[model samples]
Target: MNRLTLCAAALAATALGAPALARAEDGRWQIKLLGSGVLPDGRIDGVKTDLIGLPAGSRTRADDNVVPTMAIEFYATPNLSIETICCLTQHKVDGAGALAGARIVDHVLILPATLTLKYHVDAGPIRPYVGLGPSLFVIMGEKPGATAKALGASRVTMSNELGLVLQGGVDIPVGDGGLGINFDAKKYFVDTIARFTTTAGVKALETRHKLDPWVISGGVYFSF
Candidate 1:
């Protein structure tokens, strides 16, 4: 099965069984396993330099990815916590419009690392939260795609960037136990500059990109 289907099934099953293992929440730490959707809006912001002539109406888009993630949270008080997640997400950028059906970059692996300070409140049995944080999109690896190679691009590199993230979510306690279902969403504001080096060892092209991704997740959390 695909990753999304697998994750959804796991989430549903665990949530359904949460009540049986539920206990009172008296611990300061919580751990979670979540299925996440990495939806990115990767579009060209500007072409700073281009040795190869790009067609008019040239545009780019990034395909989305789904992956499993683990989160750790430490609650210092009843209403405050520090949270972070561990995961790696990968995506590809493809040409659009005039360069339709062409791949520009591939295997762009990223570690979207974040550290947030969260505020929580209770609405009956539901714990709702909001968070703000700084984020770093670490470019673990990337390379030129087939189309880029055809255009004489021999190397590709993207800059790692710092950005801000806003988060919101809710947790539903199924019983007295700390077992619960969690749903969360985070919005990121980030930008990166891409450089393409040709076989002649010259920087042939450079462009700026905006990759503001919306990270949506659903899963189960254990408080202890």
Candidate 2:
């Protein structure tokens, strides 16, 4: 079985073996440590300017990444909470469609700063929740790939922008001592401008891209 399948199986077995949650979650604070998967759609929305002469119907795709994530939450009420997460994910941008198999950018680092307001449902054992929030995609660093260097791109940069996040998750209580297993999913709607600069620090190309990503995570939580 794959690693993800193993993780899901282990989580299921643990949940079934544990006693059902009998009390409402009213902890004033909670924290989660998770392993997350970031899957992005880095398609070119529009080409503002292209000095590299991109082919017709050319598209770009960002590779998926796995990273460690941490979240801190404050419970304002029994059913309401405020939460935020921290993580840095890395991806590679590659050409698709007409320019398939071409690597355009490499080692792009993204730090997703996110905050959400969550509402928990009063399920019998599994605590289900939904949340919405704002996020900022901070592009820390980017390097030009082989293809970009061949096209005379000496530098690469992606704009940092604000976005929205829609979230959903379930918390399965593992024990009575404020411990649980959390599986969360967040959808991000964001975009950015990718600039390819020449050796003289002049912009050679600029393209608007859609960076919508679905971040899925699984982890253990502790309430205090």
Candidate 3:
């Protein structure tokens, strides 16, 4: 009777261990679809120009945007993963300080491509993770608004940027399968040059714009 009891215990352990092992090894790829709200929390400085119509010592502010974001994650191990994130967003630039209430820059599209190495802590149904990586900030589609054009500014141009990205987030598993909810915040540190053009004869106004933005996102994740 004791031998039969031991045999039953061993069979139960094997049955549970087999399923757990299979679950751990099967789902290595994950895709996340997120909605992100971008907030620019940096300053624009070093405004210099030869034009006379614009205000002296003027500064700028970047507007916010809510956009769709996506990421693909590959788990190299149970605790370590690599993820790539991308979102294309448009931000408006308005004058601050002396030039307040004036829209000098319009419809600037920012495309951020980031790659991160993440370390996750497994704590039952909720997993917390932190990541650090590099990002490429591609600035394009800049258009000068009416106020800028009237001030002899014919074009708005910004240089592309490369910077460091830091992120932290949590994942809450829904069921036994590989579906979960993810919430994260990311910070980008990038500095770029902005130049404003005038008529063909005048030298463009150049300034250093610090575009450090904080992005907060939340959405669904699926692993397969």
Structure candidate 1, residue pairs in collision: 22-177, 23-176, 23-177
Backbone clashes counted, model 2? 0
Q: Rank the candidates by lDDT, best first.
A: 2, 1, 3
Give the alpha carbon lDDT tens digit for every residue of 145-173 in model 2.
Answer: 99999888999999999999999999998
Best candidate according to TM-score: 2
Compared with the true structure, model 2 gives a TM-score of 0.87
lDDT of 1: 0.83
Write candidate 3's Cα lDDT for 118-213 as tens digits.
999988879999999888887888998777787788888888999999999998988979999999999999887778888784656777888899
Q: What are the Cα lDDT values of the candidates? A: 0.83, 0.84, 0.78
Q: Which regions of candidate 3 deviate over 4 angstroms? A: 1-27, 48-50, 53-57
CA error at residue 18 for candidate 2, angstroms: 32
List of clashing residue pairs for candidate 3: none
Q: What is candidate 2's local distance difference test score? A: 0.84
Runs off by more than 4 Å, candidate 1: 1-27
Q: Please give the TM-score that candidate 3 achieves against the real structure.
A: 0.83
Candidate 1's residue-wise lDDT over 4-97, tens digit each? 4533443343334333332325327788889999999889999999999999999998899988987777676778777776467889999999
Clashes of each: 3, 0, 0
TM-scores for all candidates: the values are 0.86, 0.87, 0.83
Pairs clashing within candidate 2? none
